[model samples]
Target chain A: MHLLAAELNPLGHVMDRNIIGGPDALLMGDPHGTPIVTMHMLTLLLATGLLLWIMNLAAKAITTGPSSEGNDRYLTRGRMAQLIEVITLYLRDTVVKPVLGEKTNKYLPYLLTLFFFVLMNNLLGLVPLLDLQHIVGAFLGDSHFAVIGGTATGNLAVTGGLALIAFLVIQVHGLRELGLAGWAHHLLGGAPWYLAPIMVPVELLGMFIKPAALAIRLFANMMAGHTLMATLALFGLMALSGMESWIAGLGISVIAGAFAVAITFLELFVAFLQAFIFMFLTAVFIGQLSPHDHEHEHAAETAHA
Target chain B: MHILAAEGNPVAVQLLPLVTTVVVFGIAFFILSKNVWPRITKGLDDRDNKIRDEIKAAEESREQARAAQAEYESSLKEARQEAAEMISKAKNDAKAAADDLRQRNEQELADLKQRAQRDIQTAKQQAVTELHSEATALAASIAGKILQREISVQDQQRLVEESLRELQPLK
Candidate 1:
């Protein structure tokens, strides 16, 4: 009876498709624990591969020739290579280098990976890959491989996993850059020693808060956008087909359609923006972990005195 | 449709997904950091450094060119000043030479004029003395011719007076 009802009510079907499935939809059934493959894992793996392939290609294309050769404004050969070079250089020079001044080089690779991975996942979400999977499954007699769709970053676990990684890198840097005594001083928040108890927890909480912001911010942005898009499309679909006459439905659907298009465009912008924010914020956090500048501390001391 | 769709450990993270994600991302990061990143960023850095070196070299060359131009301009100015000095000295020397030549020519011309004037004066004096003697002889001869015989002192005086009267017209 439930199955028949599910089939009859298209709205229920769409609502279920759009919002009802929770984290469970993010996973794919892998019965055996041996092969730990799921939809998010598949997308993650794909993103990693795509990044590797493109980066290698870009590496191969960049030139280090003498001045006697061709134009030298940019480093790479092709358009795609130019795009990659610009992104990498902009992020390194403008974003990463400014914040993490001394150790920009040391942690650049991970940062680059993070930015590209998030960006790729976000862009991939924009494509109707899930629809393609369904079409492909309908053509094939089964839908097992339809797992290759949806926002990989929309999964809390995936974003959480990335945050956890960022968490590790930030802490590790704090330890390395600040050292034992300096790190202890860092915990004191530059107040008198009596304030250690109050300040320590805030500093520690700050450590998690930064990465948590990264994870939640990414997950919410991606998921909310997709949800809104689905809801808008549902509106258009309902408007176009649910009224007394086809013309009436069509007239109303146009408004919904326009709104949907606008939001979709907005969603596209947000995808890139959120990914950039995640990267930019990570760099800022890592930069904060460096040892407090002595001159700055001295000036503060003088001012206080 | 999406809600009914269930796979793996539904809603909960299973062992395999976590492991796969870690493994895949790990491998990707490792491969990238080790193999790709070093070469790529090195290429980028190499290109960056190379371009910077080239720019520095260009700036250095520009500086050298500017210095050389300044030196050349200064030398040119010096040469012009030297040429002006030489030309002015030559002009001054030429003017002095011309003035000296003019002064010498004027002195020689004045000396010639004086000598010529003195020669004319002496010639005129000699002519005057000779004329005086010639007149006296002429007067005696005239007296001799007119008296026809020996004459007395009064006749001689009368003849001399007549001769003086005739010479007056000649003077």
Candidate 2:
């Protein structure tokens, strides 16, 4: 009949609900009138709190000596310092200041917060607990050895919401700067009168596409990295399962463990990279909404006149 | 079982993400738009400035303390040098005084010795002349006793002259 009746695979269990169809799929919300909450969403909120706590504590406990003392020392250096300083500087130099221009200092804080919120969310997704089995096992302790994991960004709906926010902000800023008529005209790609009809739909679609692309890129990367790691883990596990002797299983598991560890580190890099990519793209999109480079056009018009 | 399941129409597990996404997104938007993003940046900036100020103050204090210590050490070194020079000058002055006193004592001793030698020579000449005169006087008395006559002036002059020549050779 209509394709084979699907068998429920373990992948299906870890998969998030599909809202829209295919690559454009949005996250499925709750049927009981509750909104959908992805792992990434929870991760985002948690990361935001953690980031603020770390940053605030860092500021509060700041000391000038070669090393800080007591609680301040933990806040000021090592992992926390590495995390805070790297993300802050990245957002400031790459995202806020460049796109928003010299007048963007006021918005630097919001952008920085956003950058960290997204980055930490993405990074936390790579942590071991994101797996179903691991969480269950952690709760159960020695009761079970099973582990399950998933990437939050694998769901299109969550990324879609983020994109939508960026879209809304972009439009709001553009409208504020360009006014209503100017906003509409700007949407028309500022093409000649004869070209408006041809350009309008494309430009409008482009607006949605920009956000859609963001949602897809982040979702795909997070999903793919996790999927690859999971696949490799499964292969190692299968190899161990087939072994008759304990020694052989141990040998295979050791190798697999090493492989898993290597993949995990790579995924960690992917997490930060994806977040940076998202933030950078968002900045570029927002930058476009600012007043277009019309000074050159104005000068050209004046010369022609 | 199928009929009961259909009648219940319980939402399946696949739909869980959909429900979760909406609520989380709404909450995220509300929190982020309303409270989080607005104050978070300002809070961060204020904190950064505070840290910078603390660091600056600490550095300034350290610098001041270091300068004070250096100044104290330099003054101490200067004091030690001055003390050494004073000791050396006092020692040199004492040595010069002792040398001058020794030379003066030696000169006085030499002058006294020359004066003593001169006085002894004069005394010896006078003694010799007196003895010779006495001898001549005794001989004349004896002669007078023997021949009823005294010694002459020329004989007395010749005796005095002979005593003076012998005393000069002894001196």
Candidate 3:
């Protein structure tokens, strides 16, 4: 039981680790050494690569010209490509367009990339690749090797990076559209100069708070979901190893496995929902600083013309 | 209990993964913006334009058809009105011609009746003159036979005239 406890620590499955040579090495832990390449980094690259490949295929399928015989050019070709097109169009038309208005086209690429990347990472986390890698490492008598396994979005560093990018986009766009004076005026929270003393700091804090919330929300949701599934899986492992009666262990394993399956499905839904929320909130923040009335009037005039 | 304890490294924000995620995300955005998004957006725009044009064309054709139908209906109404006028004129002309023919025929019949009446009067007068001469000659012959001699011209004329005067009162 003691040996099993050491071998099957559930935290090890959910936590980030240095794949190459670092403090969190699976075989020999290096407490002082800084990680050059971690598991989450590898997962992030994989997700990016997968995103590029999938989007490339979708673009090709969507952009292909009509056949000589029929008007099939308008139709998105494959199921997967069609699904990607649907999601892209939905986010553009429904979520981003109404909020961003004319700027939707300019910013759509970044938002779309963010959504698909986060979603890919979230879904990759749900796969049992990490467990399979560990099982393979154990079989090979080398417990230190991990090629690609872990939730990149679940990590604080990764989610913080995404949120930081969102923050930069929002502020940069705000500055560009509002100029220097207009941007400073926005810090007043639409209040008179007398209220600037209070509103400035509050508005500044709100700016940082918004991105921080985004990072923490995505990170906590993903991490908690993975951790819950890991915990449920740990119960099954404990039932197998810690119990004296094999029948009781088997029964508990079944129950824990059932619960784990249910959580896995929930995590799948969370994966999509979290990605959507991140993109949607980023758009909303950007919309707040944009010249709403001017752009709307321009659009209305153009439509009239 | 073991799960709660930080057996391995505690979860914290690190530098490598953060930088890596930013780089990866930037690369994905750059590549996708250059290659994928523009094409997809263009496709959508093209499809929208095509649909709009098609709808406009359909509406135009509908309008043209409606105009043609109206024109055809109006011309049909004109032809029907023209035919009705012609029929009424033809009926009036036929009635006038028939009245003229009937008046001419009635006038010719009256003229024929008058002529026949004149001819009958002339024939009656001739027949009465001839009979009177024949009756005078027979009376003269009977008187001569009774006197056993031919009567003189003057005596016959006087005797005839006297007989005609007596017959006039009987006629």
Predictions' DockQ, in order: 0.20, 0.05, 0.42
Interface RMSD for candidates 1 onward, in order: 4.4, 8.4, 2.0
Q: What is the TM-score of chain B in candidate 3?
A: 0.58
Off by over 4 Å in 2: A1-14, A17-52, A58-82, A130-149, A243-255, A294-305, B1-171
Among these predicted structures, which one has the highest lDDT?
Answer: 3
Off by over 4 Å in 1: A1-35, A61-77, A141-147, A181-206, A238-244, A293-305, B1-11, B35-70, B92-171
Residues A1-305, model 2: lDDT tens digits:
11111111224323542233322123443344443443444554565566565655543333232244432542335566555655665677666776668647655544554555566656666666535554565577622222223455556655666677767777777788788888787766666868888878877887788777887888778767766666666655556657788788777777867887898898888877777777766666666666768554334323422
TM-score of each: 0.69, 0.54, 0.78
Query: Which pairs clash inside model 3?
Result: A23-A30
Residues A30-139, model 1: lDDT tens digits: 33323334556667777777878887787667645456755653356798877877888889899898777878999898888788778888887778776677578767
lDDT of 1 at B27: 81
Residue B77 CA displacement from its true place in model 2, Å: 31
Order of all candidates by TM-score, from best down to worst? 3, 1, 2
**Each model's Cα RMSD:** 7.5, 10.9, 6.2
Q: Write the per-residue lDDT of candidate 3 for residues B1-171, one digit (tens) a residue.
A: 654464454457888888998899999889989998998887777777878998999999999999999999999999999999999999998998999889888988888998899999888777777777788788888999999986888888899999888766534
Error of 2 at A120 (Å): 1.8
| CAPRI accuracy category, model 1 | incorrect
